[model samples]
Target: MIKASADALVLGAGPGALAIAAALSSENLKVEVLANSDPHEPWPYTYGIWGEEVDDLGLAHLLEHRWKNTVSFFGEGADNPSSKSNIPTPHNRDYGLFDKNKLQHHWLSQCELAKVQWHKGLAQKLDINETESRVTTEEGKTITARLVVDATGYDPVFLKSSESGPVAVQTCYGIVAKFNKPPIAENQFILMDYRCDHLSEKEKSEPPTFLYAMDMGEGSFFLEETSLGLAPPVSIETLRTRLELRLANKDIRITKLEHEELGLFLPMNLPIPDLKQPVLGFGGAAGMVHPASGYMVGGMLRRAPGLAKAIAKKIRDSEASPAQIAQCGWAELWPEDLIRKQALYKFGLEKLMRFSEPQLREFFKGFFDLPSSQWYGFLTNTLTIKELVSAMWKMFVKAPWSVRIGLMGMQGREIKLLWEFMKPKIKN
Candidate 1:
């Protein structure tokens, strides 16, 4: 291993890297942030995070007040040959998107004041030396640290599982469109009704499409597919046709066209990817993004601070306990039910299509709300011993068989993680 060293070596300069740096700095720990690309290159993320995290991080003022209510158009939006009746399925969530560069600048400003080392270089590969990790850059410069965080996006910096070695899925496609006018409203989301009636007859399940529409101020609305999952990728011609049809139905059109085909990929899961031994897998590398939704910024913001605290505790105690392994939130919780919920979310869209408009609204109202109370019960799979027995006695009457199965799968996955925690520890 080459000589230069630091406390932690961060291998990417993405948004998640900013948050990770911020969290560690809070505990008075020094961080080395490696920009795997040119520091001047722009970050393409339409960064979104939960509402509470903004306020908690004290960056509320930096956030645009564009989000209060969001409506997602689900169902086969393209199925109805005559889609005049195809109104989007309105779903609610506490999410917001921001300018990635601005946010990065603010975080870097803070890191500068806090004295976190910002390294400018790309990480070529990483080798774990005895009780340490060394990252070599393209310039042949090397730095070692107690741990390495592979935040290198899809480049698989160090912690990534190989495509031939347990890499589960990479679900996304590219899209780019500029608005003629501000077509999307503030706090009102107009996204791909993947199940909308506008999809081509031949557009089967191959390249999934995650629709994106963000209205930056001025008469501009950014509309394009951000990510797609398990669906056929549509051609530019096909997307153009669909976009034209959508605007026609809404009686809207835009003359100005800017850069197009931005790419967003849904987080992948299942069949535990074989990561290297012992070193920490940070950010999306650990599956922090929800498989059902590509919205991972909030999840990481919520989750990373907890990890920072755990790492701090370990340093203080001068020990890494079995409890530390159990504390690996993403690793323990991601594999189970990641596939089930994602499939069911798509199924839910199909189910919504089966309903009348009013029924569709009612179903969504119940679905998002039910999770608050259920989040606790759902924390463990198969429910508490009490709930399971009650569920059996009551004949599982609360929801559809599909939902019950999904919940069970999620819960079981959680319990298995707990079981693994009970297994003998792999000494670090």
Candidate 2:
């Protein structure tokens, strides 16, 4: 059996894990990554991020498409075959579609240069002591490190699941394909087009979905039918059918397919890993994916460096024990302020998931009507709890009577959650 040790050990090689590896390695710590897949494999998912986030990550060069304005279409008019007025609001925030092909190679090359070790294997078990953490691989390899990070994406074997029942999920299917003409607008992209004409009567029984279309340049555009939050998740078959129907409505013809992006199992409202266990969590395992939007790559990238630095500091602090170090690092990743922000976001997700098709249209109509800061902050997961609550209140005030009534129709669990979120902040 092979045995290895390092200053830190990262499980999983997704964007979150890789980012953590790079960050730690740059800190001059010995870091090794373990995952089942090859490090060179291209990420199948195409990521969209606010342009500024990409710039901060030194990944602006990885953007293949950029849009100055983003628009959201909602309301019954959006679902109309003839009504072109969906009451679109153009936002000032810049959006970019990443070149996933190049991004994987770029990050991988950076890791290599930083001397991050790569171990290709599935992590079967994790063991921790007061001084160090150990990992057992499926191939009978043992790895020990001062700090063990579970950047292992969703469905982690190392991290314990906190939720008893199913967690909320965001599911999507997308295609980068050729068309005779641009299927969507030339320069602008639709972040969420909640036109209902694409769904059949049977499909309408399920939760509402939206079209997330991007202008990829050339004759190709990337299009996705996305379900923002669902318990079991909307199936791929349903999403594909919805996408085809939406394309048909636009009279867009597909010539060739270049790539396919399918996303599933984006867990929301999962428990964060215990910091005192000589383990740390990063990426999805740490609940970094915004509960409302299921967008995480950018946030993960932006925070990874800070997390790495925190770990390095903990290791160098002679007085800090391993448990104390883990606790400090966990706090760095998810501080009290951020936890509050996440709760507000999750509350937004819970509220969003309760809407029916027509109700969804009505709710979103009110949402896009929000001021740029509120709407943008909510979508990008950058809003403070106060900002998110202000946005929610504004949306509630602006919503039609039906949507207002729907907002009040929270179930028992949701009501309990709302109470939990409020009780802590109440002053005597």
The segments of candidate 2 whose C-alpha lies over 4 angstroms from its true place after superposition are 1-4, 56-58, 77-87, 200-202, 423-428
What is the per-residue lDDT of model 1 for residues 209-327, given as tens digits with 9 covering 90 to 100? 43556555455566664333333323455455555655665567667765554344443432223433445655665545543344556556666677776665553442433234323
TM-score of each: 0.67, 0.91
Tens-digit lDDT string for candidate 2 (1-428) = 22236878889888888878888888988888888988778776778898776876788898878898688777544455456655665767789988877777666777898788888888987777666678889899988877788888876657664335557878888898998767777877888887766567887777888889887777778888888777878888888888988888768779999888765556776655554455778888877888877788888777888988988988876555556667777889877667667666666677777778888887877777788777777877777778878888989988999889878887736765666476533110
Which candidate leads the pack in TM-score? 2
How far residue 134's Cα lies from its native spot in candidate 2, in Å, is 1.7
Q: How many clashes (backbone N, Cα, C below 3 Å) per candidate? A: 28, 0
Global fold similarity of model 2 (TM-score): 0.91
* lDDT for model 2: 0.77
The local distance difference test score of model 1 is 0.51
What is the C-alpha local distance difference test score of each model?
Answer: 0.51, 0.77
Every candidate's CA RMSD: 7.1, 3.4
